[model samples]
Target: MTNRKIVSPSDMAFSYMGRIDFSKPDSPLFIYAGSMVSTKFTGTSVGMMIFPHLIYKVTWIGVIVDGIQYKFDLNHSDTPVYIPIIDGLDEGEHTVTIYKRTAGSHHYFNFCGLMIDENAEVRPENHEYDMNIEVYGDSVSSGEVVEAVNYCEHTDPAHISQFDNSWFAYSLQLARKLNARINCNAQGGISLINGAGYFDNYIGMETVYKQMGYEPHFELTEWDFSRYTPDYVIIALGQNDANPDPKRIYEKEYREKWKSVYKNMVLDLNEKYGGKARFIVITTVLMHEPTWDDALDEIVNELAMDNVKRFKFRRNGAATPGHPRIPEQTEMADELFGFITGWES
Candidate 1:
């Protein structure tokens, strides 16, 4: 047993996946698939400071230590809570990783810091990936309900926090296969137009792309495009926009809107990021609609952006209502890996 010590986010080998605000050292805001914390420590017990937001309602976190995963829930709250990670270990050296498993619509949280044993030597891992990729999508990208037994088994909130696993999402899985580091800027039910049906408000990807944090109350910070450059940018959107609801589907207008929004997004990304990345626009496998696929193809062609391309996944069975399970996600990742590598070749 050693004395306890406190470590700041800056001290850890922190890798932020999506949009995040690190302006404040004490309370760095993690939004969407915003941040992932990884560090090596020599201690018996580890704890973290989690500040919850009341607006978004829920925060689900996935903690991985020595390859085992544990889920933690930090629901709506005003004050900060200190939760213990694990205690009573051999206490030599251990690697721990913490990541956001919830969707982007959920409220953001401030990862205050970490407390560990005093005598333990904490160091950041030297893990590095061969390539850097950024994926933008909805529930699929967020791995929402990926762990459910079936499409109907885990539909409730309890099942959601228990089953959603971002680490196993197609994007991350593909990243692992290609030895690439990825940032998943995704939210569940988000679309190019009005957002998903579950939420009350309409929050499109275009509107929330630049937000510092998902919640409205969090101070907005202009994301620095140059912060981290990626070799590939994958855009997986439109399922929500093409919702099965008759009221949601406006064939003519939807097609035009999709084209316009997609074109603008591509152009904006190229301009801001200096056209260095290859953008891949994708359609949802869950709702294999030809019309939607055609719209995406047109966007790529009309823009004539040589760097932009398109790819669609083969429809695999869903795990939850509309999201792919781990097995299906694995298939998607395999497809993506081949596509990306083939493109590179």
Candidate 2:
């Protein structure tokens, strides 16, 4: 490690993907899954330093070196620690991508910098994505329980974090499938409205969509939406809105109020990201009550915004009793790819 040169996290050589809060002193905070940093280095290895805030659960990182993908676990430490994302390559030019692969609720990491071989030259990666997508979603969008291959279509395994990987989430998969830059503004067990979901304490997307980090115990910075603009804004919420067998959806007052708030959210985002931003409101392939999607349809109809569209996955609302596994996620992604592309065509 002696000969390694440190690239400060604030270095312009890093190409950022997704929503990263850069307001901190030393480094930026990687706030959501699929948020990534990409750079090119002419060296045999590259690593990263991060201060992990592991309060709820352990978080994981995903690295793509010269296009090969793999997972890296963050070091469990109260202070900054170095994790070798990629090493043992021939001494030459190589591209590196480092991303958070789990939701922030599990933990959020403060990026310190990149540890690069002193001899190597670090440069910004030049990548131009034709499409930009921002998704305000719940656990399904966050890729929760996606690694539970053995328990696909069934209840998740007793141990959750160990098997949760956002890399396989349909949202990420769709982005990859379509070669787009995506902001996965998603969380696990999160609802559209506050104080909802099956979890004992569920954080809602309405509360988190504008915040830097979701740690309730800490006062976090509000996200500046001026940073990234999206051609498409997908709202994949509603799965957690009514949990533990609630009658909220059944109540006429609650239903109308929910639609009003939801419609306004779409209107705000449409105007926020430029009035022409196309909005796709949808539910997932999970086995949720159809009323949620029904609500979405009602909003789309009421708004009648030419840019707003409603879509349902081929198996939306009836995919599985458990979280959608990798295959199921991919299934949804495939359909979505066709749907989006076909819509464009």
Q: Best by lDDT, which number?
A: 2
Q: How many residue pairs clash in each candidate?
A: 1, 0
TM-score of each: 0.89, 0.95
Q: Output candidate 2 Cα RMSD.
A: 1.7
Tens digits of per-residue lDDT for model 2, 1-345 = 779988987788888887887778478888788888888889888888878877565557778889898876665686899887767899888998888877777778888988988888888777777798888887788788888898877877776476677778998899988889999998777788767864335666666777876767556568888888888888998888878546788899998987887887887787788886788888989898898888889999999988998999988989798889999999988988888898788
Candidate 1's TM-score? 0.89
- Once superposed on the true structure, which residue ranges of model 2 sit more than 4 Å away at CA? 198-201
Candidate 1 structure quality by residue, lDDT tens digits, 226-324: 777889999987767755363434467856766787788888988877889999988655644466676787888898877998887765222334567
In TM-score terms, candidate 2 sits at: 0.95
